[model samples]
Target: MNKVLCFDLDGTLINDKNEIIGGEGTIHALKKLQNIGYKLVVSTGRLEHDIYYINNRYDLKLNYAISQNGAVINKNKELNAKLLDKDEALNIYEYLKTTDLRVELNTVSNRYWHTDRDPDFPKEYYDSSNIVHDFRNVIEYQPAVLFLVIGESDKIKVVQEHINSNYNKVKAIRTSDSSLEILSEGISKGNTVVELFPNSEIISIGDSENDFSMFELSKKSYYVGKGSCNKATYNFSSIYEALKQIIKGEENGQ
Candidate 1:
């Protein structure tokens, strides 16, 4: 049977600065994996447009791309999207408007958010994509993924609970103490992978709480750093070491 390796992109693959950390030797490792006939998939919370921008900005490549926490899927450069209803989208906007958090709304075609004054959010992303400045100006019933960055932990928790209780159609994950990511229900990296490759053996790697759903669904899941809360089967200090081990036969397609 064929095997698949799913990777989480943000905290796991790239840091906030958008550099591929610990990847100086990754291409060789990845080539070896490809030679051994393993399929590679890029799983990320970023929507399609940001993924495309980042791929080009960083010179990245992938066989398949899962974006928006699996709300969108791309294979062979063809894209498919599952959108959030306008009503639900409005609910999300209203729920988040109370906080000082910088919210970024990402669709398959464009991303919407406040201007670059907020230093916490990546201005580079805002500069590269089509951005809708006002909610009234947003297109009708467009599919979007929202990224909320900055807020006190307790406040963010309350916000998440409110989203869960009031907006059952949407789900939020606290990717970090100050960041909460909202995605359409029934869409997650793990669920998407299962749907796409129902019969394949899977291996996964990640470094944050946003990755927990995918970790829970993998045959073997490895945490990328210490102090990770998710119950990974093993822990690796970096992605490079994990890939190198696979290349050196430390772990085969078991």
Candidate 2:
């Protein structure tokens, strides 16, 4: 039986500063796992465009990807599934305008932002020329796969509280201490993985609070040692070290 390994980017595969500290070794480890026939997938809160950056930068031939916190899944750049309901999506957009928070909306093919002056703006995302819209004016648009909120941790928490209090149509998740994400109520990394790989034994690895959902859905879980994730799971000082264990099947217990 072949095992499936799903990795969360950002802190798990890369470091806190978004640097590939382990370099080619990490990629090599994944390649070795692929050679051994273990299916590998990247499950992340990042947009598909962001995923493309890693893919092109690393020259990796990844076949599967779950983006926008599992709101969308794809294989070979072809859509496999999406989790947004039009009504729920519309309600979220309406509710967001009541808040002063900056929000970024991600569709299957594009990303749009309500504000360009946001200090926490993702520079890389802006370079892609994703649509920019003013929150108050845009209406009747389809529900995006994911919504990203970047700000101070305290401010993000307040926004999350507001959403929890006012909205039941969607779910809000915090991937990092300073970011909040909104998605359809049932959309999650676990749900998407189950849908995509129904029968495979799943192993998930991540390094932050956002990864909790994936951890809940996986048969085995691991956390990179550098982040806010609990110390209970297997911890590695570097990606190469973690990859070495994974390729050897030695991290299975984690």
Highest TM-score, which number? 1
What is candidate 2's lDDT per residue for 94-137, written digit by digit as tens? 77767676777766666677556455443453254355566333
What's the C-alpha lDDT at position 111 in model 1?
67
TM for candidate 2 is 0.83
| Model 2: worst 10 consecutive residues (lDDT sum) | 135-144
Model 1, 108-129: lDDT tens digits are 7566766654565544453545
Runs in model 1 with CA error above 4 Å? 49-61, 123-126, 130-133, 139-141, 147-149, 250-254
Show pairs that collide, candidate 1.
none
Q: Could you tell me every candidate's TM-score relative to the true structure? A: 0.87, 0.83
Model 1 RMSD vs true structure:
2.6
Where is the poorest 10-residue window by lDDT in model 1? 122-131
